[model samples]
Target: MSKADEKYLDIVENILNNGYYDNNRTGIETYKLPHQIMQFDLSKEFPILTTKFVAFKTAVKELLWIYKDQSNDVRKLQAQNVKIWDEWMLEDGTIGKAYGYQVAKFKQIDNLINTLKTDPQSRRMIISLWNIADLKDMSLTPCCYETLWDVENDRLNCMLVQRSGDIPLGVPFNMCQYAVLVHLIAKVTGFKPGLFTHVINNAHIYKNQIEGMKLQLKRRKQAYEAPTLWINPEIKNFYDFTPNDIKLIDYKHHEKIKMEVAV
Candidate 1:
């Protein structure tokens, strides 16, 4: 079984069995568990679930749209055939002062790369998209907002702190994309990819998505091994990377378990 699935399924099982039932802004209530964490060694294996299909390319594209392109325009993603953000897109064709907007506004990515090269030991290396002042203008608050970076023994490590996670639909993508982000940053900064830790302050399964989660759990015993992440070594600069530059080789997994997003 894929190690990612092993850990992920455990969380799903626990949530269904013991999560706190509650109502939130979405109106559709959820079974939520607080402070759920998943840790993986990026040097050992790529952490993507093989128990069900995950849209690796689409996930990476949204990632690039944020940190690399520094864009909050939903039309930009739509141009690339990614409609994941369509639900929250505002009238001006952008998410408005969210995600990439905050990253660019604070010059977070540029400063992060520069700092990583000059001082690998700096403890202040953080990329945060949770701008309190900009929240009111945002179409939707950033869920997986902050990322803190560290370096140890020539390995680059990261901790992703998500304020809230919709386990069935969003969490899987969040885990994989951030892990790839760590690799991309490490490759550009001249270091090996080390630990990738995911922290979800409120991890929840929507009431309507419970059946999908239950079906995914049934495939746990048949999950495949983690896939090998292939990156184009020729591209040294992070800005040169495209969706095609990175890929998953030999990724075997079960059929897609369709789930709905609670808007």
Candidate 2:
């Protein structure tokens, strides 16, 4: 089994058994555990869950929309038949000053890329989306808000810091999205993909989604091995990447476990 399955399922199982029940902003009660962590060696195997179906293309599109396009508009995603951001889109037809807005506001992606090329050993590499002044303007505050980058022995490593994680519905997507981000950045910056670590400050499963979690957990034993992430070698520039430029080869997985996103 892939380390993603082994570790993620372990997290789910542990939360179901020991998580603290609580109420929060979404009004839906949740069983939450604090400070959940998952680490992956990207050079060994891509870390995507195979216990259930994940919309890989959709995840990649969202990632690009945030980093490459640096856009807050949901319509662009809608044009691609991606509606993941619909819930948080404000009246102005955008997600407000969040995600890409933050990335673009400070030229985070360009700075990261430039720094990676010019100074690989710089420890000051960080991208933050949790802007205090703009929080109220945002439809939804950034959950996976910050990423701290590093380079070691020609390998690019990233640590994704998420303030909150909706375990069943959102965590799976975030995990795959960031891993792909690491690979994409590594490719563009002329480095190999290394360790990709995910840190969730609050990892929770909504009360309404417990059965879905239990259902996915049952498939744990039969989880398939991780698939290989293929990137278009010709595209050395990050902005040129689209969902088509990346793919999962031999991706085998069980059926989807539908769950509600606690808005």
Candidate 3:
């Protein structure tokens, strides 16, 4: 089994068995646990779940829409046939000042790339989407926010701090995509992919998703080996990447687990 599956499954099992049942702002109750973490060495394996299928291409499209395009417009994602954010899109055709909007506001991606290129030893390399002043304007606040970057011995590492994570649906997508982000940024900045650390402050499973989560847990013992991530070697610029340029080689999983979004 992949190391990701081992770690991820452990977390899921922990939440299901010992989590606190409580009501939340979403009007749906949840089985939640606090301060859960997962770390991975990207050089060893790609951090994607093999117990159940994850929509890798769709995740990449959303990541690109945010970091590459720096857009808050849901229309751009819809243009690519990605509809994950359709529920949160406001009447104005945007997700407000939530994600890509904050990136554009401070040119965060540009600054991070520039710093990675010029000052590899700097300790201040960071990109954050949690804009305090714009919180009220956002349709939904950023969950997987704040990324801290590091460089060591020609390798790049990233740490993602997520304020809230829906374990069944959101966490898997977030894990794979952020690892891909590290690979993309490392390639553009001329470094090897190193480590990825994910920290979730409140990791929860919505009541509606419990059955789906249980079905996934049943396949835990049959998890397959980790797949290799393929990025186009010829692409030197981050913005040049598309869904075709990235792929998962030999990704094996049981099947898709259907779960409803709490929103």
Best by lDDT: 1
lDDT of 1: 0.95
TM-score of 3: 0.98
Q: Return the TM-score for each candidate structure.
A: 0.99, 0.99, 0.98
Q: Which stretches of candidate 2 lie over 4 Å from their true place?
A: none
List ranges where model 1 is wrong by over 4 Å: none
Q: Give the worst 10-residue stretch by lDDT in candidate 3.
A: 62-71
lDDT of candidate 2 over 40-125, digit per residue (tens): 99999998999999999999999999999999999999999999989887888999999999999999999999999999999999
lDDT of each: 0.95, 0.95, 0.94
* lDDT accuracy of residue 55 in candidate 3: 93
For candidate 3, write residues 1-263 as lDDT tens digits. Answer: 99999999899999999999999999999999999999999999999999998999999999988898889999999998999999999999999998989999999988999999899899999899988999999999999989999999999999999999999999999999999999999999999999899999999999999999899889988999999999999999888898899999999988999899988
By lDDT: ranked, best first: 1, 2, 3
Model 3 segments beyond 4 Å from truth?
none
Q: How many residue pairs clash in model 2?
A: 0
Q: Score candidate 1 by TM-score against the native.
A: 0.99
